[model samples]
Target: MTSINVKQSGDQPNSTHCRWQWRDEELVLLAEKAIWRPVSQELFVADLHLGKAEVFQACGIPLPSDDDRATLLRLETLCERWRPKRVVILGDLIHGRLGLTDRLRADLRNLHRRLHAEVMLIGGNHDRGVQLGTLPQHPACRVGGLWLSHEPEQPIDGRDGLNLCGHIHPTTTLRQGPDRLRLPCFAFDNVEQRMLMPAFGELTGGHDCRHRYRKWLVAEGTIVPWFDSAHSSRASEVGR
Candidate 1:
């Protein structure tokens, strides 16, 4: 099976995205594009965009209507695997106001309503004006000295921590000769002191990573280590 290695500072050899010491805590960056904090027993997923396909269809765009179902099934699998005490969604739970059709809302409500973990939603720009209907909304949520938000904006709640954000749907592109491959990624901006998680929603789009950040691209059921290219962060990743 393919695996992702998370090396801290000078530590090397091998370890799955299982545990990276961050903020004095162990972070399990799952290959599935979610973060599992074993200490807190919390799972973090971002940019679910539940009804995104419906939103596109409403505009007469052709998109499979089952995107939401597929997305939720993944979430259910993660929850079953980790069984976290809490699940915090960084933001963009819905694509837009129009995406929340009655069926969509009911499905969301049912999913959260039955999950064993405590669910929290940080309102994203897309979430505004949508009827969340008792989905445990918050403007920003703080967890383990990290500021969790939908966007990379500064914390408005006057609290402080490293930012864990989504909405940019960060991705990294690899090029060799004439072939180009693009994959979703977990990108960290050291200067800005924030990390952007890849979009959890399967049907979502991605924004390219800026050269300044270190990237770990998710492809083929594993996190592809940064290549030897100029934009690479670590020397560990070999192109697969």
Candidate 2:
């Protein structure tokens, strides 16, 4: 692992208020609006639409280039630090029909080789081409206690285990002074033992989660708890 210091920025909110609990050896922090597993050495991120930029460009969206490279480098930096055995992307690893371009394919192949750990894709709505086939298969893969998949399914009571999933890029709108920020969040359905991770890809968009579900909102590198019932009312009241 890279020996560089991983310090939290002083400008960022104090995460001491962020609730945390342990599962096995994992340091589960409700940070970045996701249940972070520090020991897996992997930062389980979901909805990384790697080729979304390319797809948008092809569709004449006129977005800036280098989004893919930027996202990959971010992941690379994390990998260098955590040195995880593997990065289990919950789902939606790719975007639309762009699949993995030659550049991205080569980059991913090189990354896989360099990381020395498997990069498992659970398969999602946007996955296409040989990308789905190329990802490593299961028995070797796991999240919490359940096998990972693209979409979230109702787990059998007791017998069903925790499933980490993504697809509905979840986000919540919060008021900060006069400005309203739509912060990406992690939604945890405790009754279901299932968690939805925020979209890790730069090109990905998020859906408003207010009044829909209880969530942990992550912004400025800090996690804030918000219940579904209070979302809209709180937002409106804070705005005034």
Candidate 3:
């Protein structure tokens, strides 16, 4: 097992952002909105829900058509920066089959052509409606000592590894006096040994998860590790 100690940046209390150490690998929680594993040369993004805007538009709901474009651009920027060998998407690659417009398909195809990294998608509940040819699909995959999946589930009977998943679209709420702030966050359940990724989709909503385990809030181009009120004073102290 691996352990984490408090990480300090310069002289400031840098509890908001830090690399995640697991087993024998060190993973970077990128501000570009994805997990970058330098050891494996892979990037993990979850709950993309591509084509989501189209789904809403189909239902006569006025939604921005540029939603997918924005999501793809963010991904492309990350790809350009990290230059990973593979980009593993946890799930919700597409909102639905009907929502997969030709333009969206072309955009994805172009993205795959432009980037050197291989993109792979794992099926999720929302993925059931996606056409098979829209995106390459897999049930699950193994990365280093981690099990990657769309839904947060324990690995098969004998497998022993930390599970990384994205389905609930975890978010965290911060309360200060009468003011409160809610933001998408990466949630880690220490007891279950699982990590929940925030949604990468531009149009998808988030589910607020304000439980006790560790949380990394993504805001304003920075990833912040949130310490509860009880432990706020010790935020500078490191060690898991």
Write down the lDDT that model 1 would get: 0.76
Query: How well does each candidate superpose onto the true structure, as a TM-score?
Result: 0.85, 0.76, 0.86
1-240 in candidate 2: lDDT tens per residue? 222222232444447235444244343544433344654655566777877777878888877768888877777766676667877777666676664688777776676666566787666667634444356433213555554555777544444566667787888776545555677877766766666678888887887765546666676666665643654567656655
The better-scoring model by TM-score among 2 and 3 is 3
Q: What global local distance difference test value does model 2 have? A: 0.63
Give the Å shift of residue 107 in candidate 2. 1.2
Which of the two candidates, 1 or 2, achieves a greater TM-score against the reference? 1
lDDT of each: 0.76, 0.63, 0.76
- C-alpha lDDT of residue 41 in model 1: 91
Q: Which pairs clash (backbone N, Cα, C closer than 3 Å) in model 1? A: none
- Where in model 3 is the C-alpha error above 4 Å? 1-17, 132-134, 229-240
Residue 14 miss distance in model 2 (angstroms):
2.0
Alpha carbon lDDT at 180, candidate 2 = 55
Task: Please write out the lDDT profile of model 1 over residues 1-240, one tens digit for every residue.
Answer: 333333233443333364555567667777789988887898999999988888888999988889888888889888988898888988888998878888888887786655677888888888887778868668876776788888996665676567889989998766544455677988878777788999999888899775677666677666655533443532214333
